[model samples]
Target: MEIKFEQKIPVLLEKAGKKGMTYKELSIKCKAKKEEGKYFRLAVQKCKAAGLILEKKGKFFATQSKGLYPAVIKRLHKTYGFAERLEQKDEVFILGSKLKGALAGDKVMIRLSKHTRGNLPEGEVISFIEAGEVEFTGIAHLTKGGPFITPDDIGNFDLRLEGSVKGVADGDKVTAKITKRGQGHRDLRAKVVKSFGQATRAAACCEAILNLNGVTPEFPPQVLEEAKFLAQRGIKHKELLNREDLRNEVIFTIDGADSKDLDDAISLSKYQDFYILGVHIADVSYYVREKTALDEEALRRGTSIYYANKVVPMLPKELSNGICSLNPDEERLAFSAIMTLSKDGKLLDYDFKKSVICSRVKGVYSEVNEIIAGTAGKEILAKYRDVLHVIPLMKELSDILHHNRKLRGAPDIDTAESKLILDENDRIVDIVPRQRGEAEEMIEEFMLTANEAAATLAKKLQIPFVYRVHEYPDGEKLNVLKETLQALGLPAREIKGNVPSKVLSDILDEAKGKPFYPIVSRQVLRSMAKAKYSETPIGHYGLALENYAHFTSPIRRYPDLTIHRILSDVVTQKRSASDIKKRYSEFVGRSANASTEAEISAMKVERDCEDCYKAEYMEDHVGESFDGMITSVTSFGFYVGLPNTVEGLVRIEALPEGQYQYDGLMELKETHTGNAFRVGDAIRVTCSGVDVNAGNIDFVPAEPESDENG
Candidate 1:
């Protein structure tokens, strides 16, 4: 009987597990004929490549290790692929061909591709695991042989269909289910699941984003039915018997003018030389009980995704915008955090309870900002007279909290984000920069206090819980920061050991008022580790807190919802029993993992949409020149950021003709003219083509045209 090389390796590897084998001994054990020695040797190599067997000191042994690990495909370099931001290790290196059709942000199971002498083990993707699940929206073509779908971006390979074409024509855009994979790139295919209208249209772009990210833009029928039923079912009178009645408290919610899915409200009271601050978060858990369709849907979503003109709400709007919302003058269910704090913002004590709160007013951030600025119109000031007196007190507390946070080494990296305004037709009307004002900051401070209070309580109880953690930056990154500072002619401060966040914060303060402050701030941010959900308390480095949990925004973030459920169980039950502890122990682990994954995925979706919106806005501005700063440098080119935060690349070839090389500081220097362009350098650039499908905006260097000439 003859076995193929692929088949022969598994048998040899299984046998090798019992005892280590030398190549000569393995050849003898294989019982292969002289002609099959090369084939047998090839089989051994295959086994090694798949990481099923390992050779140490010239003896082969079965690894007995399921080397499968989920890795993020960050970038594809020549002949090699890189897996970065992995939970298992710092990074996993992969052979390019062994990628098995993976792209950036794709989650995949990988094993060792090969282990060579004096080199780190490289990996190969064995399977593409679903982040949630894979579905691509793209344009499809009907060929004579069969119909195939091509993703709008990302995957360049056409997905061949097994059957006949559907309603989608040759040039039509469609969404599909990835039913099967071909052995090679050419054979990969999917079934046409749904069809959209045309490409580049408003609906088509939105549909493509939702499908590609595996985000359902609407709630399921059953989930909607549940929400509608609950909306009609008012809170039972008996349910309020034991709850704290805060209906008389001077409580109100502050949000954007157009906001409706309000989930948190704030109240304040005077208490002899101190202040009583109350943060009332919507009691979403009361309505969304465990195992229900509503609860399942919310967990699956993980978080809401907001776009230029749309929002994919985590919960059905009937609840998020209805009964669960803390609208003004309405009595609503809430999980309240009542804190007593001194004038200097020291939390003396806090109490948590299920409460019924009647909010006095619904305030807008813009109007409240006006009040703080002393520019509020008489009518606007009068409208908010009930809460106007407390606004100044809120600011006083906010300043104290902010000062204490800074003293504890938490830096406030305040950077403005872009807000793409869309017209009714979904076309980009304008792109504006949105900056947080006093009103927003005060609310943020109060919410942070509430979150901190809840986290402290959870830790005190010593129960299983998930904490939001931002770990300290590694030494190598601080070294890079040191280099960046040196390049900027700022002090290259040496970090002795595990440096405090204040050290970095001080460096950022030095960069203040500089033209490249944004670049420096952003680069430092990139050097820091991502904040994630963890079952264990490692402290939040960014917040400089020993304990922290997300107790706010339960209507949107699943982590907050999970926290609420835990608090409900622990507080209501009056003790963490064995059953409850075991249940939450499992929940803490599973939810942390799933929720972190979901949060990252949702962030990617948001970034992708932001890029799309930027491209849409820039499409009409071709040939227009604007002043921008060089924000990034790569071998291909450098990216320039406009004032509004839109970044476009200036390719190396487009630079003033010369051979440019990357300096030690990552600046591209021209050999002939000796002109050097590094990050933070201000340059003028003309608008270039916008590749919407690829989410790229290209720019060429030029001097801005004078207004008189125009």
Candidate 2:
């Protein structure tokens, strides 16, 4: 009979006691033949790799000894890496040589050593239980040994290609998959799986970015077929049995000039003491039912992503831009929130219902802003003739709401988003700041009112649902902000734990209209926690709202779709409270987690893609000088932002000759000259170099210059 080493090894080791047993003793206990010796040795290696046993002093033990901890590798640098403990928030620093073939995101067992780098604990990886899946996007180059890829994310070393480069040549942008993991960057091997034209072209680099982030433009055939079939079905009378017919209401959508996935519309009516604000969102759940292929795909994607002139929509255009879109003069299914607000913008009462609406016009933000300013052209006025009466009322309600938000201390931070202009050949020509108008604010206020109503309804009924939550900032981050403020000669408050939103709002209010407003706003934003979807209704800190849910834009947001689905059951009285909870408890948790992860992924993709386009545009203007402000300072360098929203790095080495040291807050100072570079300092910079493939722009001070303090 053959010994099952997998089952027998653990028991045998445990039976051998704490003293453990040597390899020869274990083989003897198993009664293995000469040929089986090799098999036994292989099984022991497998056991060790799986963390089932630990070997010390030539003896194997089934249980782990003291000081051994489980950790996940968080990041890998050229000479070192950091791994976070699985049981706590602490991190361990491991030198590249001690990584033991571990990669980022790998789960491994580590043993702490009597060493420390700064404040971090030092450790060495013992064994890896799992490998992380990471794809590398880079420019492929031919070397004497073979072909290698210089990754865009990491510049420490190149990844060696294991096989022949058949279709890929030098200077081509490519994506590679890991074929073999190694101890460090120098030994890792990968295989080229895709090639995207030349590396010099921003379009090709953008394509590689999409693949690297797993944002597929094309959908599965089954999902597309289902979407097409459902779209063709159209709106049937039987499906509108309990829905309210509001097709005559003067509802309209306001969006960008080129937006096609129209999701939300607004209508307002004035009363003596209160206003009836009707926010009707597209009923996407009517077509995308639970567990269907279309629903699965939307859930996987979570949200739509827009970059430059391109979009990776969560739903197929057949539904997003066709059936579920709220187009002008088209009767479409909608979920309406009829909110009654006081004259002072306080919510008095609300009702939600299934309805049908016909949009009066497709409103453009710029055109509406022009109309409000009385500068619109005759053609623009003629386009909005049907819904002209409601424009003033929209503005009135938005102003009142804005005042209310200010009173309640909601910090208004403008990050100044960038817009990229592309030529006929898909090459970027210019970069500029994206403009926002009053029409955008009006629409935003309406959406917030509707979202708050939805969450209040869910809380009143105590139902399981997904919520958009933003918690308070961490204490450590807040402390860092206080130190930075004091360093810049700004007011610093004494915060015990978590400070309220009003405190940060006051700081911003004081800094408004000043040259340092940008720097102050950036610091406040960095101190705030990120908003995410959750099954629990944690109030949003930034919005200063106790109740909030994403009830608008169902066509583009998965959380909004989920809210619509749950409200369907409540409004139709299809299920009792207990039944609803039993059916959706687990579902809500899963959707919230999946949606949060997908949203983060989509954000990264958009930011990275925008950087490549910006670099491409900057490539044409090299050596041109521009006046810019220092937006941020780091240990290695500082970043400068131009009026067009383009940012570039000015490394410490590029500055005037001096021994400079970082103040660890917001200033980089030189020891001998007493010169310093601080945030919000005005300086002249000349574009020195551009790396389109890596999305990097380098800048240096133009001609003779002195530090900000001088």
Candidate 3:
């Protein structure tokens, strides 16, 4: 019997390997064991019944192979607890379990149990794989019994303070590190590392954002010293001897009114029937050389971060805003793209060169817009007479290019508001709406034309380069969008198959004048995939083009700087194709990871600053009534966006005088009151109070108006 059982083991292993059997296959294999030699079958049945070997799909296999069990697992590695990976199964297995010990960005391995009759995969905790190294930033609360740390960020779970680190008092913002993990408990043990006062809002906010996004804000002291040395060395005109000289040309820069770090400038002239345009980008690679401390630090950062009131620059301030900045009247070094184009925005010929340029004028969008509108002020007219002469012509050419872009089905998103004015204390005072004026549009059109020309030239030259790519949206998400639009009585047929940008643009146009327009537009934008940097050209869906790259903004973006270095080497014949390919492949992989991390970090910081401002703004308006729109709907409650665009939750239990029942079919309808509230519905509410400590704004329904007619 023992021999027979041993002989059957190999057959079972082969069957399990072939069929991909889950645990249910073991029971069926046990029935087959009963049919073999009776005594041997009984012994095999006992082993199967003991659950030593399990079946997955249809075949039996040992549960423990290489001391690791076959268990389905999901890991969360982002601040939002987004699932990052699945092990052994295509499905996520931790949808309903209580994440007791897990933080927002923890990674845990799980084991799958038998599925119920109607349910899908059921998972149990296997082991904690990795704990994210995020230090909690908040005010420390002290009590006679013990101290506790309540985080400023709402999503974080609270931490229990140790006696040794309980020196921090209540209302003092502090940073704490987890000292011990609590199993099946609400709070984890932590030690306060630093206590900061109220004056540290900006610094603390920066730290919180960096921690949440898994980034380190401060550079190593060695990196800082290296940057200082590089800045001091600066760019020299002697180095420009081997490059093109574009100082004779009328090059100008157009940016925001408050911008200081000017990275790119433009010059244009009529060369016979075609127009010659020059795009002069600051030569960041010349200062930040390869394998150096500055380069290493810049590579880690990948891109500069612009928040509401501050900038976390990729390079040190001395370099970013001083030496490398293309300030007017300064002889700055540049990597230039000179392209000759026809009257219809078609590229005729182009050249990439490392060059020297002296910007003739520093232009801003508003001043240039006035010039284009034939309303230039006396100061502006005197300061930029050459730019004023070309403003009207540039507007005409830009309009033609914009029309061509529409003809090509490029997705043109609506102009969104950007934070403008800030108080002396770095709090948001006002939000200024940004309009796509003629000057801004002209710059954008010229930049796009230059980038496309450079990309096509790189491909023709067979040089390695990094291209910005945005793929098509996921089909599942498109389907969801289709269903949602149909329910909202909007045209959604064009969303199927290969969705053209025209269809999305048309939908956006039709949504105008409706209260739900912004919400719908935001949702449609979210359905699309994020743009990423890669060496291989996958095309850009947003631009509706076959090839696109970032040839501008080299001072702020690493990919553009890398492209500049590659172009410089190509033009000078200093590097071989093989070397370029090897370097580009390595940098592409690193750039992809670094760019993603940088973007995530920037987004977190931007949102954190916005939340801080929202809390500060609400501090003055407690108990005031305002109108709000439903922005999000969930099982527990719905999120409301006030007129100022700050969002807060409206808990279902707080709905006045009504028992709210969430109807899946209707999204959210209260059966008792027969009142429906879906996303985009407007309602009146009053602020209860601002929870500054937790960064939360609480609201309740406002009282109805009195009947003056009666």
lDDT of each: 0.80, 0.88, 0.69
lDDT: which candidate is best? 2
Q: lDDT per residue, candidate 2, 1-710, as tens digits?
A: 23388678878887776878888888888777898877888888787766567788998877544356667888876577899987676999998778876777788888889999867999999777778886678889987877888876533678888777898879899998788866656778888989998898888998999987788999999999999998898999887777898998889999999999999999999999899999999999889999999999999899999898999999999999999999999999999999999999999999899999999999999999998889999999999998888999999999999899989889988888998999899999888899999999999999999999999999889999999999998888888878867876787787437688999998888888988888888988999999999989989999999889999989989999998999999998899999999989999999999999999989988888888888898899999999999999999989999999999999998999999999877888899999999998998999999988878899998886558896
Clashes of each: 0, 0, 8
- Native-structure RMSD, model 2: 4.3
After superposing candidate 1 on the true structure, give the runs of residues whose Cα lies further than 4 Å from its correct spot.
1-137, 141-149, 152-166, 169-173, 176-183, 187-191, 574-579, 703-710
Clashing pairs in 1: none
Shift in Å, residue 43, candidate 3: 32
Model 3, position 40, has a per-residue lDDT of 54
In the range 212-317, model 3's lDDT, one tens digit per residue, is 4545657788888987887788766589798788887788899988888899898877766777778888888888888888888888787887766677778887
Which tens-of-lDDT digit does each residue in 38-126 have in candidate 1? 78877877666544556678887655434455567775543566775355565777765777766555666677655732245677787
Q: Model 1 misses residue 273 by how many Å?
A: 1.5
Q: Please name the candidate that would achieve the greatest TM-score relative to the true structure.
A: 2
Question: What's the lDDT of the predicted structure labeled candidate 1?
Answer: 0.80
